[model samples]
Structure formats: structure tokens, C-alpha cells
Target: MLKVIFLAAFAVGTVLADGELIILNNPGSVHFEGSQATNQSFLKEVFTVVLGYTPKLTQPWDGVEIRDPFLLPEALVSIVIEGVESVKSPRGKHFPLNVDEVEEVTWQAVSRRLEERDTNNTLVRIRVGDGLDALGQSALGELKPNSVDPASLKHLSLNNEEDQKFIEELQLLRAIAQKIPSTVTANSKPDVYWFVVSGLRPVMDLHGKDSEATKEALKLLNDAVNDLSNAFTDIYNGQVVVALFTNDANKLRNTRSVESPRVRREEKAGELETFDAAAQNSSDNLNTIEKPITLRLSKRYSANYPVIFNIFLWFGIVFFFSLLAICIAIAGMDPGRDSIIYRMTSNRMKKDN
Candidate 1:
């Protein structure tokens, strides 16, 4: 009964993606024709090429024919390049790029770069599952188990291999679906066709695992796929959707799981100590970190000198006038002869008399 539901869900997802393009990155068989390329250069080259060919989709079932590729005047498309560093330059030289900071590099700019014949000598053989597994693992690893609810902890914990696998699969599906909405809708486009660039390896690995983890993973993956289908359906309501698929889709779907040697060795070595240490470090960082306080001087209250000077000026004028009035009053009024002011006035009066 579960398998039946799974198949039905898969069928629905496949139908929804009938015209969508899936670009898979195969990192296992990268071949450099000329000089060895650095990770930075290789990434830039990949972005340049992939972005250039994204808009022009051709009919695969029929003879090769263009699918009416045209320029989008103000169509805002989001590009999510997974596994690549966000920084355009070396770190420390400038702030590292956050995932949220990735903005659209205009299709025109990409096309112009391609037209200039700015090609790299590296020829990477596109494989079935390139960076998907690593990306999925990273996403799952970043989850803080303690931060989640006790009920949610079981599903998120990596202590059990099966649980880890399930979480990885679910995260991979979510990641792909997330990239589309995050870039397209979050940035600009609301009702226009948006594109997603992702790897298929992690999603493919969902089939190979048969443990309880696999069951849970399948359920989550199905839900995510359904959500993506609904989202894209709404996005494609009145717009033409175009996607570019590279490499063979059959191979991508049927690819076997290749576990990283480092991951396997780490599993053999107890992860408990490492996990505890990491948790401690994170707790320490959080505890010791100070929240920044910003001080702002408002325009309305920032200027004090003018107000203070005005008050002082008014007080001085009043004081001077008060002193002069007292002198005039003393001259008009008479006091006893023993009074200092009276003696001075009498001496002046006696002289005048």
C-alpha cells in the first residue's frame, strides 16, 4: 500500500515536470584539457557555460528544434549555485558571500562573456551524482539536534546511519525545491516561469536504501516533490517555462550510491566525541557572543549648542537689565544716612544744595 502511494506520488511529480529541465553536475570525472584549473576558475567557467545555454531548450523526442528562445525584458530569474563559495574573490580580501546575497547575473552579461570566447581548457565529464550527496550531507549536518523538539530530534539525529540517510534524502529534495522559490519569487518574479539548477544524485540515492530511514525519507521526499509541483504549477499558469537538461537523465535516475571514504572512516571512528565537542563549541560561542548595540543621534535632538547659546544669551540680557533697573531705583528712593547708598546720595545732594 505504501509503495502504491509512493508510485502515485512519483507519477504526479513526473507529469508536473514534463517540460522542466534538470541540470545535473557530475564532479567525479572532471578532465582538464590544458592547465590544471583552480576551484574558483572551474566554478566561474561552469556558471558562464551553464547560464549561457539555459534559455535555449530543444525538443528531445522529436528532431532537434529550438523552443522559441527569446530575451526576457525584465524577467527576474534567481540562480542558486550549490557547493560554490559565494565570494567573488578570496576571503579576507572582502566579506564572504552569503547564500542570500546571490543576485541574478544578467543573461545578457553571460551571453556576452560566452560570445567573447572566454572558454576554459577544462572539460568536466558530467556524471550522474556530482555534488548532491555532499550538499545534502552538509545541510543535514548543520542542523542542531538539541535545538529541535524531542519528537523532531529522532528524525534529525545522525547517530543512527539510517536516520542520517533519511534526513539527507529529505534535505536534498527540500534544497532543490528551496532554490527555485528562494531565487525567483524572493528576488523579483512572482508569476513568471523560474528555473532551478540542481544535482539529481542525492534524490536518486533515495531508492537504494531499504531501512526504516529510507521509508521515512521516501515519505518526506514525496511531500516535498508534491509541494514543488504545486508551486511550479502556479508559477507556470500563463508563462512559457524553459529549462535546459544536460547529460543523460536515465543514468542520473539509475546511479548507484557512492559513499565518501572520509565519511565511512569517520563513521567507523566514533562520532559521539566529535559531535559532543562540536555541540560544546557551538554552545560556548553562543553564550560568549555579545549582541551589538547601535547608538543613533536623532536630527531633532542632536544639535545642542544653538539651543544652549540662545538660553545663555537671553539670561545674560535679563541679568544686565535687572542690574541697571536696581541702580535707577536706588537713585530714586531715599534711605537712612548710615546706609552706604544713602550716604553716597546725601553727599551728592549736599554738594548740589
Candidate 2:
């Protein structure tokens, strides 16, 4: 019954795919050449394990073509036991159950454990059995007992070795999938087609170089190309021609140059308006910058400044100083015999002083 419930959750397909594939390699932080192949089949498998089960195997199946395979068969058979329920054995019930009852009990345990996903009123907790840490090991070298620490989850580790093994197995599956060739007909088919299409109609990056990150950055690039290649032979696939390489050094210089123009315009904003009017007042300013003209010079020239007066400027400066000198002299004059006006002013000024 537990196996039946587990199998029901996953749907596996072993059909040959008419889809595109993309294989990316970033092993040890180094990229390698990308490959393309045609005519591949995709296989899916599913299984289940109890929470306490150990020594479980995860492996690949036989009688299938695995392209760029990354996993082995022996690893697949391991059982992955995820904790499904937190229950004290019923009526103090211990282990040693019959095969007929195993399925029903396993399912009951799973349903109980699954209750945690639905509970929203309070903080959810998982009972970590024993002293397992993040690396899935008990205190020292011993295995943790079948007990959960709901509060000490931070210190708790997954003791499920089967799950870890399965993850590694999945990587192998992905590698093999990359090696297979599939057809790309529509956007929903696969991502490999996009990568191939980008190669044909290359787009230049901002720095006038082929984009290094575009193939990796854009998801559609890979799907469109791989799928299209799979759909038809003789279509370009599996080739990574450089579309753009960012020149960081040149970009930095351009960023610095961008600031100068902004600064010049801001500083000259109001000052240039006055300068332009003065330049227009005198043709000499325009003459400074050489210009070709077809018009002949006239013998007669008009002087417009003859009507504008220069005398008022000089007279105004003189009058201002004269009034200032008079005020200072009067302020220094004696109060006794200056005049009646002085006397009246002196009397009032002295009283206020």
C-alpha cells in the first residue's frame, strides 16, 4: 500500500522524445565544448522508501541509451526514507509487523507526517530523530535513534543517505538528457533551439562585441536551437560562435567620459546666455571663428554707438562720491556756529546720544 501510494504521485514516460536537448558543462568552474546529437529517448522512473530505512540504493535502469551519462546502476536501488509521520507506536506496539499489514501502516505513517505541510495556525515542526546534524550523521559516528527533536531542528541533520544518492543520480540523468537529440517545433518543445538560433542571427553586445553570457543568460536561445536541430538535420546546431564579449576596460573609460559633458553643460547654463548676447553685439566675436562668405564688403559702414551716451556714466560716478564727501564733512563740523539748522539738529542729536 505504501509503494502504491508513492508510485501514484509520479508519472514516468519512457518514450523516445522528438525534442531538442542542451548540454551545459561547468565542471570545476571550467567550461568545455558543447556537443549536439540527434535521435534520443527520455526515460523516467519513480520509487519510494520509509523514513527510517537505511542503506538504500539509487541507480539507473538497464536497456536504455544514456547520452553523456553521469550515474551508475548500482546506486539506483537504494531506498530513500523520508520521515512521514511522528507517532508513538499504537498501544505500545513494537516492530516486527506482517507483510500484509506493511502497506497500510506505511501509508498511515505518511499521511500523519504530511499533516505538517497543511498546518498554518502555528509554526510547523519536524521531529528530528536523534543527534543527526546538517551532514546527516548522529553524534560522533553512531546513528540517531528513532526519535524526533521538534525544537532542535537547527541542530538536526537529515540522516537520509538514500536521498543524497538520488540527487547525484539525477545529475547523471540530466547529463544523459543533454546528450540526446530532440526536435524543436514550438516554444513549448525545448530550450536548445534558442541557443542555435542566436548563433545564426548574432546580436552585438553594447561594447560592439559578441555576448558571452547571452547563450547562458537567455533561456530561449538554447531551447530554440536544440529543438530546431532535432526537428531537421542540416540545420545548424551545437555550434557556439561568439556573439559578444564584454570589454570591461573600455566600459569603465566610457563611464568616466560620460560625466564630463554633464558637468560642462551644468556649469555654463546661465553664463552662456549673457555671453551669446554680447557676442552678437560685436561682429568681432563672430569674426574670431573663421567663416566663408560670398557677400562683398560695402564701402560705407554705419556706427550705431554714436547715439548712446558715455557722459552719464562718468557724471553719475562723480555725483555719488561728491554726496558721500559732503555727508562726511558735515558729520565732522562743530555744533556751535554752523547754522540754526545745525544747532537744532545738534540739540536733538545730543539728547538722543
Candidate 3:
């Protein structure tokens, strides 16, 4: 038994050391809750397999709330990771979060976006966060070891004051946007377009409620979008991308309540079916893509290393046991050598004769 166990462990280790990469996209539909959930699942799996990390997947609301803002807070993250594809193994793992920051606003915004009547036709929201830094954080922690300044640790923060400053900037931009001359004639032959991005806190309480922190946060986001748009106008031709991120009173209501219960139920059923099909198709496409891609440590950094490690470990064990069985069979079938008991019995038989 001891020999068998050792052999098994060795076999398992070898397989894991040589795993493969898998890619998955974020959810793009209203019914599917975007790709955030898939992203989290991929993260948990990869971290477990590669680095022996065990991160949990929480509900979007709970997960969003606990996330650190300054770290890389996007509503959706795209993950890529290496995982086993054996008959008895977990399907795959991926690392998609571009920024590790919480998606507090994005969650609510997604909810609102999905609930709208014309949601199906809306342009897919594409968001990108700090990319290289985001990947580093996902692989390890936020520590720049090779920095010339030794005190870099003191300034290094996964979540820091920068988020607040950015939020404030967003509000100021919104203010500037409101002031921008709306009279600028729409460009008939626009050469360049302006794009704006902004964000804000959630919406809670409507009556006589007055919370300075919340109000100020919202204003900052509003201004940020507006100002960013204005800047684009100044730089570009007559037209600009009119993009903005905000926590407006109406923005939070991206999802609307269903009026008729029957219709609502039917719509939900249809949406669910569509989302399921889309998810299946997306997964299949990813699998096709991963065939040519080599798996590496960087690829599977977000996975829980131990879990992944154990899978290969099991495979090794199975292989070892198989070898042990072969050895035992050979030992049992050695017809050339007689056993000691058999030899002694044969000598006694000759003496008796």
C-alpha cells in the first residue's frame, strides 16, 4: 500500500506540471449577468491549481461591496488560465479580471441595463482598466521589488486614495459638461468623436435623506464625464465621443420593474434560454482557441494552485499503480524459479520413495 501511494503521488505530480491553457470571455448579455460571474469562477479555479490559493466566489452584490476600489474596479474582467482536461478533472480555469477593484457601481448598472425594454439592441459596453498592473496584481500582490526607491512599499497600495481623487475628478468633469456649449452644431461630417468615462456611488433613500459623502461622490462622477467630453471637443474636430460614467438617480434604475407578471415571466424564460446558448457557444469557441496556445505559469496565475496541482497528482498516482500491477504480475509468473517450500517438499518425496 505504501509503495502504491508513492507511485500514485509521483504520477499525479507529473501531469499537473504539464497542464493546458483555457480562455473564456465575460458575459455580454443582460440575462447572463455579464461575464463577471464566469470571470470569478475562472479566478477561483486557476488560483487553486497553480499557486495553491483558494479564493471563493461570492454573489455579485456581496463580492462587489468587499472589493477594494482603487485596485482595478471594472464591472467585468476577462480571464485566461491553464487547467486539466482529463475525464475526471475539472473542466477548466481562467483569469479575466483586468483590475482587481470592486464592481459596486457596475453591478447595479448591469442590473438596470438588463431590465430595460430595449436592452437587446443596446451596444455592448466595453470597458478596459489598467492592464499590465492589473495582471501583476492577479498573479501576485502589489509590491514593486525592483524599484530604485526602497520606500516604494509605503506608496504601493492595491486600494488607495487615488480612487477617491478619480471619483472627484469625474464629478468636476460632469459639471464642466453641463457648462459646455450645447449649441455646438452637430457635425455633419465629423472627423473625430469624443469619448467620456465616469463613475459614482449607489442610490439609496429618496425622501428627506441628505448624505454629504454620497452626494459629493455622485456630483464628482457627473462632473468627470462632462469635463472629459468637453476636453475631447477641444482636441478633436467638431464632434467627439459622448461617453460618461456616472451614478445618476436615473442611472441606477438601468433595470426597470416588469408591469405584467405573465409577460415578465415569459421574457425571463426567453432571456435565460438565449443566455444559456450563448454561454455554451462561447465556451466551445474558447476551447477551440486554446488548442494552439501553450500553457504557462503566467497564464494560470489566478487559479488555486493546489487544486490544479492535486489533479495532476492523482493522475500520477494512477499511473504508478498501473506500473506496480505490472511488476506484481511479472513476479507471480516467474516459472523458472521454484519456491523454497516446494524444493524441500520435493527432496522429502525423493527420500520417502
- Winning candidate number (lDDT): 1
Best by TM-score: 1
lDDT by residue for model 3 (1-353), tens: 43353235334433322222222111111111222222221222322221111222113111112122112111222111101111111222321232111223223223332223123322222121222232243211232322123232232222435333333333333433343344123322212111222222222132112545444433433344335444444533322223111112222123221110111112331111122232234333333321222233122122255577789999999999999999999667644325654555464444343
- Alpha-carbon local distance difference test for all models: 0.31, 0.24, 0.28
Residue 213 alpha-carbon offset, candidate 3, angstroms: 1.1
What CA root-mean-square deviation does each model show from the true structure?
24.4, 37.4, 24.4
Q: Give me the runs in candidate 1 sitting further than 4 Å from their true place.
A: 1-59, 63-157, 165-212, 235-353
Report the lDDT tens digits of candidate 2 across residue range 1-353.
43342233221211211122222211121122222221111011111111111111122222222232121111111111121111121111111110111111222223332232223211111112111242143111222233333343232122434222222222222322233333222111111111101121222232123344222223332332233223232222322111111111112222222101111112231111122233234244223221222243212111222233346766788999999999999888776655766768664554443
TM-scores, each model vs. reference: 0.26, 0.13, 0.22
Per-residue alpha-carbon lDDT of model 1 for 1-353, expressed as tens digits?
Answer: 43353345334433332121222111112111222111111122233322223221111111112232221111212223222222121111111111111112222233343333324311111111223433333322322111223366433345654445445444444554444443433211112222322332232344344445434444554464444444443443313122122122232223221110010112222111112242233332222211111232112211355678789999999999999999899778768876776766575655543
User: Model 3 Cα displacement at 142 (Å)?
Assistant: 19
**For candidate 1, which ten residues in a row score worst on lDDT?**
256-265
Q: List the residue pairs that clash in candidate 1.
A: 26-127
As a whole number from 0 to 100, the lDDT of residue 301 in candidate 2 is 15
